[model samples]
Target: MELQLALDLVNIPEGIALVKEVAPFIDIVEIGTPIVINEGLHAVKAMKEAFPHLKVLADLKIMDAGGYEVMKASEAGADIVTVLGASNDLTIKGCVDEAKKQGSKVLVDMINVKDIATRAKELDALGVDYICVHTGYDGQAAGQNPFEDLATIKSVVKNSKTAIAGGIKLETLPEAIKANPDLIIVGGGITGQDDKAGVASKIRDLITQG
Candidate 1:
């Protein structure tokens, strides 16, 4: 399993500094939806320029015009672009096709999707790179998580790699590892901690051990 550091609340510079601290432990540095909205694709480009070796994900949470959005994000140095699972099949296919052309990837975020298993199966068939079960901030506030949703997608998604995100912290890292997702996403889990590097390092160790 690979660990992804989600940078949602930080600015571009703050995000860069945070990544530098945990670079050794993270496989992907995500320019989260909020940062993307505030800084545009520039956040993706900045992160890529700062750390060329680590993957940069643009959390566009795209709801429409997938091909165009994915193309723009790819040009901005995003290695992976996200499209909502609730989107049309054509939109998802557009993202997959465009991402393939750009040598990038499409990660379908299954947040608020009513039927994760069925949608994951369809997205997998559409050749998405990753199917992620995510609980948004509001959901997380309501005490929701992606664990069960992760299992739902894991059962039927055959071709695509699986991922889980939403309020994942060091304490809960073991539970996420037990789910055996290809990618594990954490935001406040590491970012909110006092010793970011220490927490990230420990999380990485757990993932490696798992």
Candidate 2:
């Protein structure tokens, strides 16, 4: 399993600094939706420039014009770009095709998708690099999580790697690890902690032990 640190509420500089603390423990640094909204693709470029070794993911959650968006993100040095699972298949195809040409990757975010298993199967066939089961902040506030959704996608997704995100903390990480997602995304779980590097290091150790 790979650990991904999600930088949702931070700006480019803040994000860069945060990643530096836990860079050794993470495989990917995510420029989350809020940061992209606040800083544009510059956040991706900045993160990539700061940490050339770690992969940078631009969480665009793209709903349309996948090809163009992926191209722009790739040009901005994003290694992986996200597309909404709720989007049309053609849009996902566009993303996959463009990402391949750009030598980048497309991670389909199944955040609000009504039928995850079916969509995951479809996305896997459509050639997305990763299919992520995610519960957004509102869902997390309502006491929802991605653990069950992670299992749902894992059951049906055969071709693409699977990922899970939202509300994943040190206390609950072992439960997520039991499901065996290919990528485990943690935001406040590490970022909100008093000891960011310590928590991140532990998270990485748990994943490594698995």
lDDT of 2 by residue, 120-208 (tens): 99999999999999989998899888888888888887789999998899999999999999999999999999999999999999999
In model 2, the clashing pairs are none
Off by over 4 Å in 2: none
Alpha-carbon deviation at 159 in model 2, angstroms: 0.8
Q: Could you tell me how far off, in angstroms, the CA of residue 156 lies in candidate 1 after the best superposition?
A: 0.4
Compared with the true structure, all predictions reach lDDT values of 0.94, 0.94
Candidate 2 TM-score to native = 0.98
lDDT (0-100) at residue 201 of candidate 1? 94
